[model samples]
Target: MKTRILSLILLTVFASAAPAQKNEQNRPPIIDAHVHAFEKDERWTHKVANPLTGQPMTATTEQSHMQATLAEMKKYNVVKAVISNDYQAVLRWKAASPDHIIASYGFYDPSSQDLAFLRREHAAGRLMALGEIGAQYEGIAPNDPKMEPYFALAEELDIPVGIHIGLSKPGIAYDDAPKYRAALSNPLLLEEVLIRHPKIRIYVMHAGWPMLDQMVGLMWAHPQVYVDTGVIDWAVPRKEFHVYLRRLVEAGFGERIMFGSDQMVWPETIGMAVEGIESAAFLTEQQKRDILYNNAVRFFRLDKK
Candidate 1:
């Protein structure tokens, strides 16, 4: 009986240890360069279907959403994330998980007062980056004169600026943002901004999907520019996403691409986004690591952290 019991105990120990070891091998540390936080509101209480899988994603309250996001981060071994949202929401999420969160300022249109507030936040060490700057939704191009001040601020502060430069929700112009224009999605529109603010650190969010030629040209012209595979990583068809990603890599911009879930209300997309990169058979393990973590560390200056 003692021999049998000891054998069973050994089996149990090995069974428990096997999965942990496998998980460690399968899930490498990640640094999500794009994420969002939202205030608890009725807006998130409805199920939204995933565009790629067509599966309904459960809704959550503000508290539950934060909890779920953090849980997802832990599960995937996401060491860090750059989170953008309204000021209060960003603060709450940062407070809840100080070590995991990098606070970013999210804005649509900004006034001088908003710039002042951002300046103060940065001065106080509360804000690290500025973006998800959805100026495109307002029909504003990256080089629009109205956006000069914001870019100037970021350049002056030496913080990275993330701008929305590509596809939004389907029919966004018809229903959600009437000002949104497909022409504005062209990454080339940012050329002037890069020219004027040569020193500004900028990342084109969504990797300027569906605009492959322009995105590659812009990156070739401006080596300082980086991009994040945000919503396109999970929301688009897997094959399509891979084609776009592969082209960028083949064009020799692999080192500049970073991973971003563009995760809004659905926490599951975090895993989906990570899998999107991991599933790319064309990317070697080292290239995958660059996109998933190393690039962001260099882009965000996380080594200082």
Candidate 2:
């Protein structure tokens, strides 16, 4: 009698769970444009007190971290992620998981060696684009001569540049003196650099928050300009995401928009970004498909493979 009761209870629970599980299984697939992975020792925290104040890196150990990243991608139906990381650190991410994570080489250290490495990796087609670069932190401006070589390499390679130009947290430093605040996060600073490097494609990360209108205006003005929705949720509300998407669509640049989860805090963050895009009122079924995958496929030239 006890065994029969236990079996019946198990059957009842599974019967109720089946449809919900099926619904999840049947949900549309997603392609996360932006995702992050790194070994625990690769963390940039030691360079600075907080990650916001410093460059972003992972804190998990190599063996388990790589497995977790792959598992999350498989479980969430994430087709691919355009990955960029510092030198030395996060090398295992690409070595261990190449299919899911497309790696790019860039180092925060502003030296010729960094640019040289970027040029070499770019020439080998190891990097799809030139960045997660630009002057998010202080003491670096978009037009700094130090960055010209990398820009030139990007032009020669004919790949887009992924730039992070937007408001960071209150405590994050832009330089020795100023913290990365709303005022300094303007996308207009990129104007001079874009003018100088017209041939180079630029994907402005974070969509230039606090100056979002200006960012949209910049994208409208520049034909090669694009934006990715990475780590923007913390700044923009869910409704605002729809509003922004609709605005971009109305501006005739919907096709250029890419979805990025900015998966540093957690693996589930990727799923959250996909859910946000799906839940947005501005996106129709077709638009959702484009934002989730098709756009990235075309932008990254993934279809060629």
Candidate 3:
């Protein structure tokens, strides 16, 4: 009779909790940790490879792309996106919808960026992040001397950084960033920097894919480091992505992984990135919720907003 009574109580508790759980699961807002916005007249456009054709994907006009991005954000329930773009361009886009965009300083050359300007923007609440600091494209590592100032600044200010790590698309060497180095993709190389700036909120942009062991080692050693599923979430071959992601999840780092569209010129890919995380067969419902929304919220402190 005691056992029967206990079971009834347990069922009653679960029944009462079910609705709240379901409501929370349905549509929690997302924080897309990595994305870039391009102006139409700007020479640079966000590029994505066609998974099917192995060819370049074209984007509509810059105006159309921005419109599509915001629309998709609404459709996907993404409340905020961390945008990496030129300083003025970031200002223009964020000014249009200040609440929705988290301004990030996108640096091509770490040595060339104006630290003073960066600090000012960050101080003004116009910039909250410091990357897509793509040194790998220049055959540079995250720990390169040129990167020290930028990393140090982020650490000093307690701003989150989303750095590029891991492989670039195949044949990227043929593109403008010919100096791309595959070896620099290793997440372990960031150790020195991590050690130097222990308190800085940092997340590897690609989650150091194809370097899973290294990334796992990095994560195991440094609890402060986090990651985002950018291109791999949408662009990589599904099986390859899943194998790496499954191992990461199983190894007890699921809480640290966040979602990023890496949506450069491709606005439509935003939904694809969301679908990639949502469609993962290995992740449970709760795990999906964490990856989709909760984890990023914690990483960026978006809940405080």
* Candidate of highest lDDT: 1
TM-score of each: 0.89, 0.78, 0.85
Compare the candidates by TM-score and give the number of the best one.
1
* Segments of candidate 3 deviating more than 4 angstroms: 1-26, 41-59
- Model 2 residue 222 CA deviation (Å) reads 0.8
Clashes of each: 0, 3, 1
The deviation in Å at residue 60 for candidate 1 is 1.6
Between the candidate structures 1 and 2, which one is better when assessed by TM-score? 1
Give the distance in Å from residue 59's predicted Cα in candidate 2 to where it truly belongs.
7.4
Deviation of model 3 at 257, angstroms: 0.2
Question: Which pairs of residues collide in model 1?
Answer: none
lDDT of 1 by residue, 110-129 (tens): 54337778899999999899
lDDT score, candidate 3, position 260: 89
Which residue pairs does candidate 3 place in steric collision? 46-265
Segments in model 1 whose C-alpha atoms lie over 4 Å from true places: 1-26, 54-56, 111-113
